[model samples]
Target: MAVLKLSGTLNSEPQGKSHPEAGSDSSLSFLHGTKLAYASNLVRDWHADLLHYQGLKPGSAKLHRDNLLRLLNHARVAPWELQKDHVTRYFESRVNQETGQMLAPATVGTYCAAWRGFQNYMLTAERVNELFSEFNVRPKAFVDDDNSIAVKRHKLNWVPKGWALTDLEIDAIDETFRSEIARAAREHSKSLLPLLRDRVMFHVGIHFALRISELTELRVSSFCASLDADLQHFGKWGVLTVTGKGDVTGSVPMRDPSVHGLIEWYTNSVRQKILLRRKSKTEDDGRREIKGQMVSVSDLMFPSERGGVVCPNGFRKRLADIAMKSGVLRRKLTPHTLRHTGCTLMVPLYSPEIAQKYMRHKHLHTTLYYYHPTPLGAANEVNSAAQLFDDEEED
Candidate 1:
């Protein structure tokens, strides 16, 4: 207020916030949450909604948004009509081909929100402009009159909340793949290193419980236990930054010796195979695959025969075979089960908070699903010490 007074331009009501002596300047859209209710820049292209649709369908989130717009255009829904009520109804009206039933609640919430946000943006350019106007900026009016309308918020449900795998299940998969992997390696004329490959894949994933993507993205550098050249860095476990969902990166440590042994065996085999000179060898002088200060471990710690990124599904299939043979689980198990095993193992050793830190979970409750403590069904001492120490009554 004082600054405004000194500048000879006092801010009017509904524009600037006051602290009795001073105030600051900002867009009228700033009042969206307060007096205006969703004025401008408050939206994120409904990105979460788009991601949710993409999870159901196989396209980029933007492509999902485009498809939603096409649906609305076909419906001939007006710009203003793209409100929460209309959006929800439009999606509820969509039918599934498989079951011939109306779209599920989860699907409807996502598709409708994506459709409506895009429709609103295209048909109502004036809306973004009017965010500056004091007259009309009530997003609540689209669904609420007296704050009484029942409206559901739209958000992406991709990368679902509960999906960690169990240890027994992971072990089963590991065992299932062992013999078969060796057979396949022998048949394909490939080295026996892949059997070790499959084993290490199972071990690292179960012990550290890294995501399949994280496991595949691993580098030889990440497996290093030491960094100092003179200090003998090789054979030691190393930490690497893993980029996960939403491009969020986390540092996960490797502790399993089996993981290192398998990797070591594979690396030694790779060097031996290269020395033997069987296939088209890449020239050292020419542009190599790896760049930067550190020598990249040929793109991935686990590369396919063609030396490209390993197929995630192929890896899963291999592990599935292992699980079936391995007596750990009666049913099929996945890499995610390893994550569950990793968390479960930590339950007795650390607090949920510490487990969450290692797992890099935003919520500890996600870690809770993997943890189960043993129940006390019976006491070890059948006859209590109280019986032994009981005072004898005068007979």
Candidate 2:
């Protein structure tokens, strides 16, 4: 019997000496003298099949293996011996562990999907008998209306109360970034690059209502100016094309002249300064050569100190710091908060339909969630109605 080694480390190994039937491989020692040994091997084979036949990525295959392993261990049964009752009991136990709180539908669905995939694989491979063929394990329906079984619907009009920034708060945030930029420029600080970059990020994020992922993944190619038929130069009015959720690509018009100027200045001056500094540092260190591909200014919209893609966590932490400095509650400020602020302002400034288009939301309902009516809007409506009544009295 050839022992198969699975990728990633196992949590625990089987106790005592390895069985002769289990072979001499150390990786297979974890399965020695256990009922799960053969089942584990089958899972390893299934992982390979997923990679080779199903064309799944290694990370995805690992997730499948992890999910399947949990089920097998909980049931303590071979693939052929797995019954619907055993699977149901496992799910019930998991639910009970939550102490009366309902498990997320997605969480339960993943468990069911992993089990179903493993069972189907076994059936196809002729490893399991017909008894296990009809085993059906699935998550119960978790719908908002308590009616739909297949899908869970979230409240479309749900937005956190007081999530959007007020005019004063927005001004404070803008001032904080501007102050940082000024300080760095005056001091000729090494932090100048990051200050400039973050300021641009803030403007872009708020203006476009971009998700953090979309904002961070932006490249030089994503932004274009009207004057530059090519991406060679930045113009007064710029357009940014972003790939948002659901793989939908949309063009966001940077109508704010100040935002366009900030981006243009950063691209032409501050970005090059940072890149040059990195290059000089790399040369002085003589450690490892910086790759030619990484030296391009157009590669990433925001590069790290080491000239790599900026981590999303880093972006969040920087934003948090800026928010705190601006005297805003750190918890209240997030990338999404900026997005909400953009959408909130859009409703009053333009229209709900325009907000939907600007935010690139799939549904108008999603846009409606962020449309917070201002007091001024309400007062204006009242005044308009009152004027109409007064005119009627005169007539």
Candidate 3:
């Protein structure tokens, strides 16, 4: 990878406090200028290492380098002055300068990955490590699972608060949505089909504990029933063979009567009506351009207003809108909230082992960490502790 060659005058006085370089490391201190020459050099070197040593493709290396530069530019600090606070601030800023909408979780996750990769390279590269040591500065991995959305379901939940929807909230949402659908039908509104589609999508997502991408990417063919007796846990309720993160395809068994029934209503009644409307509006044969590729909207379980795959952002907004309209759990609830809520409810209805299997998590700890020890479980634990004390006193 070619280095970012720039011609600019270096600032004599650095913005940050000066670290007294001992002996030979003093020579490298000059590189830390107010123009961020040090950061530029670090990124350029990391890009080359990614290409030559890590065997990353040229395009991939360039992307990593570009993302790193964006972060560095936003911070306006040299490598030594960089901190986790800078990263937090960068992510909190809007992606669109005019609209002022926060960066998407996926986009922030990508940038966080690039930052981690650069930090790892800095620690491993002998010369780079030595260069930082001489200046009394250490490269630290700031963006981690604790802060980044890549590992945590929501960026807002970095502090590990309760975001799962309660049973009462879920019921309120269902009632409100059903009422809205009934109202639309009574008035002969065009929104009736779309409302039904949204309702079905929401019910299926919460019941199945599906990620946003999995929910949006669902197709008619993805649903399967009549598996061998030994293969299914939910019997005739069927399973969803979805391509999840890392392109790992797995079967998510659906047992909820309401979920499967809602899906049936959508596929049999609502889906066909939407496709008919799409066919009338556009002469094209149910195929349209989506992100550069032509896709048949008729196959998608949850097609958008434009008869394409549902946009994740739009789906999130609709969920938020539903909560707001219902006046229940009016906090910022994303699609992942449903996943958390489902997993939370699962631990009580079934064992943690079953919940882990149902979630398809690689480790049992993940299931425990996110959704174990429900309110009832915690209370039971306290009661058990009290019983133990009582027994000890009696002895």
Candidate 4:
């Protein structure tokens, strides 16, 4: 296999940070000379092709780029030197760098898909020869026949154990935040705006089943309220255009009256306070720049105190603190915990099909895997079966 001895450490900076200048070639500083230029050109060309041919958004293409870089950095070998085993081992080694737990199978599948895309790109570029045949490096070998790592269904008597929250727990969390918001308002505390924001975010995450990224990236314009309708008079029926994984856009209906009320409150009252606070800051304070450009409060649904988009990490930490204060600190509470809770509750109230749509899952199987029968559901089924047996015996 031909090995390219690229000299330089991989760009260790945080992902998703924008370049300082438009169209500026920030060559990977860790790479040296011709090798750097070659790798950069390859990624740039691949990104352009994805955008032009596949209609992939720039963010989606960047994920592929980052995935490829991770593999290259780990293997320390040329693209041609990459074998199927190398790919498999790389995924196996992926643990939560902080928690030291294995990543979810779906996440690993994404890495496999990115690797497959890069392999296809190399083939199209005529880089594959006898020594580096496509068959020898097929990405399918890394996953099961369904193109996912096999995750077994939970036991019939299984209950949520940190993977998801119960409906009652969700209610408690909601009440906790609502009470805090009320207290802050009564006391005229500076935390009133933040408390209101957090409360609204909780509603959005639970009712819409949105991922943290989608929730935080939401813009005010994303919600489509009816025309000729005032904010107070508008009913709880609007469409939310959500940009989900893989850059796929889907519209989710906002049917929950409480969610609509929360949005109205946040927009009319709480959001204005946040904007005024931001407006009070001076330009020289360096709070205006976001991804190298100034952002307006109208551009974001949930802006930070500094007038930029809220950081996902900070939002999660705030949520955890709320969860702790609510006396539900038995397990770590994340935005995903609320998402799972919503999907699980949906399955019992509606059909799995509705749950799938509510969760915005592209596949029904994905919804079924996470929203299976609980212990109470199993007991109900057993009782119904016994009644059927009694009827048959009497007949």
On lDDT, the candidate that comes out on top is: 3
Clashes of each: 17, 0, 0, 1
Using alpha carbons, what is the TM-score of model 3?
0.58
Ten contiguous residues with the weakest lDDT in model 1: 1-10
Residue clash pairs of candidate 3: none
TM-score: the better of candidates 1 and 3: 3
Ordering by lDDT: 3, 4, 2, 1
At residue 87, give the lDDT of candidate 1: 46
> In order, what is each prediction's RMSD in angstroms?
16.6, 11.2, 11.3, 10.1
lDDT of 1 by residue, 144-171 (tens): 3211112233122334443444444544
lDDT (Cα, tens digit) per residue for candidate 2, span 19-56: 31121122332334543466567778898988889877
**TM-scores for candidates 1 onward, in order:** 0.57, 0.57, 0.58, 0.59
C-alpha lDDT values of all predictions: 0.50, 0.62, 0.68, 0.64
Better of 2 and 4 by TM-score: 4
lDDT of 3 by residue, 18-128 (tens): 742111122233345533455566667888899989877787887787666556656665555568888887766533445555655666677778888887776676745
Candidate 3 lDDT score relative to the true structure:
0.68
TM-score-wise, the better of 2 and 3 is: 3
Over the stretch 1-395, how does candidate 4's per-residue lDDT look in tens digits? Answer: 11121122132434465752211224445566655665577677777888889887787887777777677666655454566666666655554445566645545556767777877776653544432453354222233433334222212333544366666677788888988888988999987887789888887877777888888867777777644344424443376777777766776666667778778878888787786686444444433444445645566888777677778898898789889988965888988876776665566566566667767677765665565345566446423222322322110
lDDT preference between candidates 2 and 3, better one: 3
